[model samples]
Target chain A: MTQPQSRIRRSFGDLSERALAFWLLVPAALLLGLVALYPVGRLLYTSLFRRRLTDETGNSPVFVGFQNFVQAFSDERFWTALWNTLLIVLVTVPGALVVGLLLALLANLPFRVKWPIRLGLLLPWALPLVFAGLIFRWFFDSQYGVINDVIVRLGGERLLWVTTPELLFWAICLSIIWKSSSFVALILLAGLQVIPKELYESAAVDGANRWQSFWRITLPLLIPAILVAAIFRTITAFQTFDIPFAMQNGGSSFETLAMYVRTMSIENLNFGYGSALAVLMFLISFVVTLVYLRYVRGADD
Target chain B: MKKLFWLLVAVLLASTALAQQTRLRVFVGGQQRPDVMRKIFDLYQSRNPGVRVDVEVGGATSDQQQQYLTTVLASRDPSIDVILIDVIRPAQYLASRWADTIDKYLPAASRQELLRRYLPAYSQANVINGQLVALPAFADAMFLYYRADLLEKYGFKPPTTWDEAIQQAQTILQREGNPNLNGIGFIGAPAEGTVCTFLLPIWAAGGDVTNAQGQFSLTVEQAQRALQFWVGLMDQKVSPPNMAEKPQDTIRSEMQAGRWVFGTLFAYAWNRFQNDADSQVKGKIGVVPLPAFAGGRQASCLGGWQWTVSDFSRNKAQAHRLVRFLSSPEVSKILAIEASNLPVFPALYRDADILKVNPWFGQALPVVQAARARPQHPRYAEISEAIRVTTNQVLARQKTPEQGAREIVTRLQAIYGGR
Candidate 1:
């Protein structure tokens, strides 16, 4: 009985030690809750209400369970916006990855001009997003646009780059590619640097050509980097609004999910619907993250 | 070296402190020319010493509002004292009590001066939820700008009705040939621009998108007729080849070059048109009211910004002072003369200086008088979105006008039902 009592006392002693460590971490834990968790929780709570702010004096936030969600789902514009967003992701994600990989490969080349080429390629990403958006808007302007001017001179009809929904979507994708490809390239370039060159030298000795070496060796090794780049690009593209919003003013076929949420929350002042739409966007982004975690993170493993 | 560094730091700190005293941040949109804003600020500061307004330009109004709201909601202290709101949004802000009411700062007589001097619609735009929330900073109304030279050369008078307009435009275009001229053009791209500039013509054709009660009053046949007419203009070879792709800015540029016979545009372009620095038809352009639809009245959309005080602002008195000063009759006249901003006062319509400097202003008075505001319901933004989608569907020929109209009605009913 004395031995059993001693053992119980020892167990209580260990529990207290761990409890002290956890208590020591409480400040940082509380900080995280304040900065991140609290806002998200608040957003979720706000989504449950109908928020109407009139003249700063008459803000009435009332509970309207699921009504906002119902409206968002039933609206065809919401569906069209969703469709447009998906189309953009499908077009932009693969295009960005391929271009980034190509840029990385060129940068990894032994040529003397590689450094200049790499810097030049990455210059677009270094520029501010808004400035880049502005430049692109000017580039795609139909009447005085350099793009249209060139097309017309080359014996092609002028294409409305910012106005038509179909053309507007592609124009937006072009801006995204210009701004984001360099970022992807930089990431992949880092990944390529870490890779041992001896593997490629050995493959060459075995009579494998450059294409074969790339597919067999570089691609497999680049997978981890490629996955990381895609996760970043996809997330950014999903929330993509600046380029489209700036270029087309979110009126043309270029209204992304982010733009829709903005119009609802800010323009329409329907915070409930805006919140609901934002939550749905969050869920989509969350699913995308999970997919990346499972497929890309799993592949890395 | 240490002493020198200290001296440098002292100088920097002194300068920054001095700068802070005069610095005032003013936020504007992406489309607003930064250089023009700088000039305006310089002019404002030259008159008002020791006060410098810093411009914080953001994206379009929607994006700017997102940034503005997030800032206001996040800051414990009200950082933004004066806000420039779209004319449509003052009501929402006034309703939310986000803006301070202008009652105390400007008494009844001064306020009445504004109502009497500016156009009724312009004055009314700022009266959101019965509180005067903002002063009109700039006014933009749709005006029919025709090729005066073309009409005079071809012996064709300005058409009074939509059919007459189309017939006259066709005659000019057929003779002018494809490369030299297109009959008419517009902003038909699927954006706010499309809805703003293009929808007026449709509404003027005696069609309604939605009623004030938020019911969709657009008939399937009427909706189809409107779409068909716009597309038919292209098919009948009246408008440019890529009618659906052009923005209003492009259409304006083409019209300025005398490449297009006529176009409808915002009145702000008058300054550019009269300057002749870049225009081919600088002296040959004329402004008039948009053609009326058969058995229907001409409609023009009202566009501009209104000023509102933040409810969260601690300096309500100062904010009120700013609004009143900005809207004062004398200041309104100065802005109209110097900045070419339209006077918001109904009585300012007869201002001699306004007529002397801006002949276009006199021509636009009738258009502004007949102008109607967009559906003033809280769901106007949503209504705009619905209109954009349906218009695109029609333009793309993906959905018939009847089908698009049905879709719009169903969608609007859902929005109303949810509310």
Candidate 2:
């Protein structure tokens, strides 16, 4: 055992620093390839075929090239699902950001007992997405829902929060904002904590007002954290499934891309088409991430 | 030395017992009452001591169960020996070879006898391409549930035609000036139940989504007229304005709360309406065959579960025995009396024990006999999605009846492509 251990140490010592670094990275690189790259590569490969799991003939997957992608382009349902997903991201990301910023500011206030406020901020984020969806689904029920009850008490006409497509869309967005804003706030709060207390003290000495300090100091210093939060939230919003599914079981008029993928791949057993749709979704997310990274770099400069 | 010897003997005996036992896993949906099924399994085990049966309960809803079973079967997993499937799934399962044909287990004569025992509609659903693919575990059909007291108070009989039903509902609503009370309730939500909602009117109009040749051949005019009838109900305020969002459970609860004079629901709701502690409509409920379109025939959408032996099961012979045992008339009667599951055997409907426990089942037999299965194509799921989604859109006022009808035809035509 001693001889083998000495030999291994000598071999590692023999390598140059750069070479040693590369050698050390081999295991991690292999793991990344297995966990991340393999599934994506398989998705791409499957997207190029015509494969139905239920085909009785037991025929092997036939090469269809880009036909699945072509079909998705012309498929009206596919376009509707894509539009729904984009609308969700566009609306919910900004909605969560603004709400999250306010929450972060409030929580950042000098309270003697900070843990309780932080814990309160965490409660919504910690709740399961499906649970949040179900709670809100009841809240929006047109007949016996609490929202309608309140409105009726206030002398307002009852609105159909779930039956109408526009209202259902807003209801889902509201739920998403409620669940995700806490996560954004927690991130933003961390960013706030890292800012030097002396900077704020010095700003106060210069006679800057509170609002001015928030705008000129806190907001500017919080960009990196905000960008990080936006990146996570935007990607998650693109993959919105549980909330919409629990609310309406992916109703046709309000279906997101992820839900459509599930309908095709799992429900219809049409793997090829579903994979193509999934690949398209991945490309959109990838491009958005690239743009955000570019913006982050620009902001740093 | 004697104690050590006995210990060795016990270990040897345990190994032999373990080796002798053959475990069979049966997958049933949550709605099937797996707890009750476990009792039946116990009986089977006692009869066949060498076989140890295990129960795996699946999702509550048909859609969820289908997704779970599809994933399991597609992988050709042998873990599930016997599968309980929705009534509409035999064709798809058989076509995919996920289910083993029953002919191998039962001879033609015995299979014919077995099929004859079941209701005709069930036999029609289970037998595909001249082969028996499954056995019905129970029977179900959509029924028009009404408030008996309310209908009597208004001096109206159960409406037999869609037109009469609407007219009676309107008059009742106008007379009973309760703002909270609605005329009728039915599922218009985008759920598996909506498929039946979409098909019910067209079927009542003597039209079908598929022709006898199993091709897409929906009559566009019939579909349009059927859809317009539903939209008219909303426009006339015979149904609630938010009908499009109500699912089967929601409709059931609303009806049970005495919010509606009439509702259309499945056979299972009878149990809840009568027995659930919170039910307000108890002792005042009446069920009838769903109303027909004028000049057309009455039709109910067939809904039930069936037992199938998994093709990948290692012990197919034992699985066949278990399925046959579970689907027999004797066991069917037990399920009917114990769980309120409608028996697949027509004779069981008249059985004194079952009728005593569920008197409404007497009315159910005729409705069940007249019930029709949804299209039996392998792509039935997609077909159902198209119809239900379009129906939801029409009910939600996103599309005109004509647009919805044409879209269904177009979508089905595309799906059937060159067939």
Candidate 3:
């Protein structure tokens, strides 16, 4: 009995030492909670309440029980923004991924075009997004746009790229492609480098051609990296605002969810409704991340 | 050895403290021209020898506002001591108690001087709930710009009434033969610029988005007439079809290109039209007040920025001094000449030296005096956006004017519910 009691004492002491390490981490953990999670928590808290401009100034935060969210869901503008946001994501994510992959493939290839092309592919991402937006806007301008000017000079009709609602999406997509496809390429190139060359060598020994090897080996191996890149790209595309906002100035047809959140919050001063919309966006992106982790990461792992 | 090490450590710590003492971190929006901003800040630093003000300008207006306001609201010891604010937002800041009311610090004589010297409406706009929330930092207002040579060449006089203006535009369109040589270029974009520039014409024609009772002011017939007139400009091809997307600057540039004969523009446009190296029609452009709508009073827009102190500023006294100094008549005149901003102080507009520097002041000063402010509601930004969106929709042919106007009224009611 005494031997067992002594063993318990020693185990308790060991446990205390482990506990001391956790205690040391408490400050850092609390700091993360305060700095990172606190605003998110406040956003979530505000999302559930119904408040107005008056409520924001000195009125005690009241519990309205999902009314703000309900209003957000019912608001046609919210749905319109969601639709536009989804459309932007749908157009941009796959477009960026495919183009990025193609560029990365060309960049990864051993050719006379390799270094210059690689540098060029990386240039868009290197340049500031605002500059990229302005450049694309200038290119797509109806009258002064170099693109339109060239077209008109070549005896073609001028196209109002940012004005036409139908064209606004494509113009924004063009800029998104210009600014972000390079980021996608950079991410994929990093992934492509991590891929084992020996796998391709083995496939070559098995008599697989370049295309077959790429399809069968390189792509499969790169899936995890591709998934990571896709998830980030998707989140960014859904929150697409800067390019569209810069191009069209919070346009009627091109109001993305991110832009609407700002429009409602700052411009409209409906912080509660805006907060609710933002919370929904957060929940959506978080769920998307979780799903990606479960499906993509789990499959890879 | 221990004594020597302690002495070195103390010396290093002392230098670090000194470095930290003189640093002042500031934040501003990226909308300002970066080169000009750098020069301005460089001047600020040179003038204040001991203070090094570090500025971070964001790319977008909304992003800058959000980041700056969030920092000010949440910081235990306010991180940013200076902020550049949009004019429409001072009401919100004042109401939320995020901005300091500078009236207490400003001398009564200076405040009275501001009132007596500036356009009455613009001066009143700088006041919030009877407290001087901000001083007018820069002034902007729409002015009626007509082609001086064209009107004279065609033996036509500038119209003083809405009907006369429309007839003149129609007559010009009929006679010019060139589709590009329209009578007017209206900023029809579904943006804030559209609301500021185009709404002036509609409101001057006796149309309003909201009435004095703060209720929705657009009747279906009145809204239809406004839309008809706006689209009529396009039907006559006076405004380009692409105008639904064109920004204010684009129209200004086009006008400078002599493609359009007349357009409404901000007062600062005089600088761009006459002085821009790229301008072709320099010294040929003319400024006047927008013509009155049939039986309606003429109204231009009152748009400008105001200076305010941050509620959490550590140096409120210094900030107040800066505000007073900047708003002084002398500073206003200097800025008017240098920055090409419309002087908000009336005295500067009347000053002989200012008029000498800005010859167009003779025409533009009256426009500023006659300018109409958007609504007095703290939610004017919200109201403005709804008007912009709905107006854009109509101009884009997506919705009828009636539908768009009604929708806006509904949104306005929703926002201002039970107020």
In model 2, the Cα lDDT at residue A151 comes to 94
Ranking by TM-score: 2, 3, 1
Candidate ranking under lDDT, highest first, comes to 2, 3, 1
- Model 3 residue A156 lDDT score: 92
Q: lDDT tens string, model 1, B1-419?
A: 99999999999998887775545555566654445656666766787665656776766544455456644643434666666677766665655566677776777887787566666786777775566777776666777788898888789888778788788898877776666787877667555656665467667876666676546575666656777777777777777545655656777777777787778777766666777488888878887887888888888887766766777765666555555556566665666675566767656667999878786676676777777677565555666677765776566555666777676666666665654
**Cα-based lDDT at residue A202, candidate 1:** 98
lDDT of 3 by residue, A2-24 (tens): 99989867766666777867977
| Candidate 2 per-residue C-alpha lDDT over B1-419 given as tens digits, one digit per residue, 9 for 90 to 100 | 99999999999999999899999999999988898899999999999999999999998888888888888887899999999999989988877789998899777898888788889988989998998999999988899999899889989999999788889899999999998789878889888888888888888777888778876678789789878888889898899778778878888988888888899899888888999999999999999999988888999989988999999999999899889998898789878987899899888888898889898888889889889888887777888888888888898787899999998888888778722
Clashing pairs in 2: none
Q: TM-score for all predictions? A: 0.80, 0.94, 0.81
For candidate 2, the per-residue lDDT at A60 reads 78
Backbone-clash count (model 3) = 2
Question: How would you encode candidate 1's per-residue C-alpha lDDT over A149-188 as one tens digit per residue?
Answer: 9999999987766655677778888888878889999999
Better of 1 and 2 by TM-score: 2
The better candidate by TM-score, 2 or 3, is 2
The window of 10 residues in a row where model 2 chain A has the poorest summed lDDT is: A51-60
> Scored by CA lDDT, what does every candidate get?
0.73, 0.89, 0.73
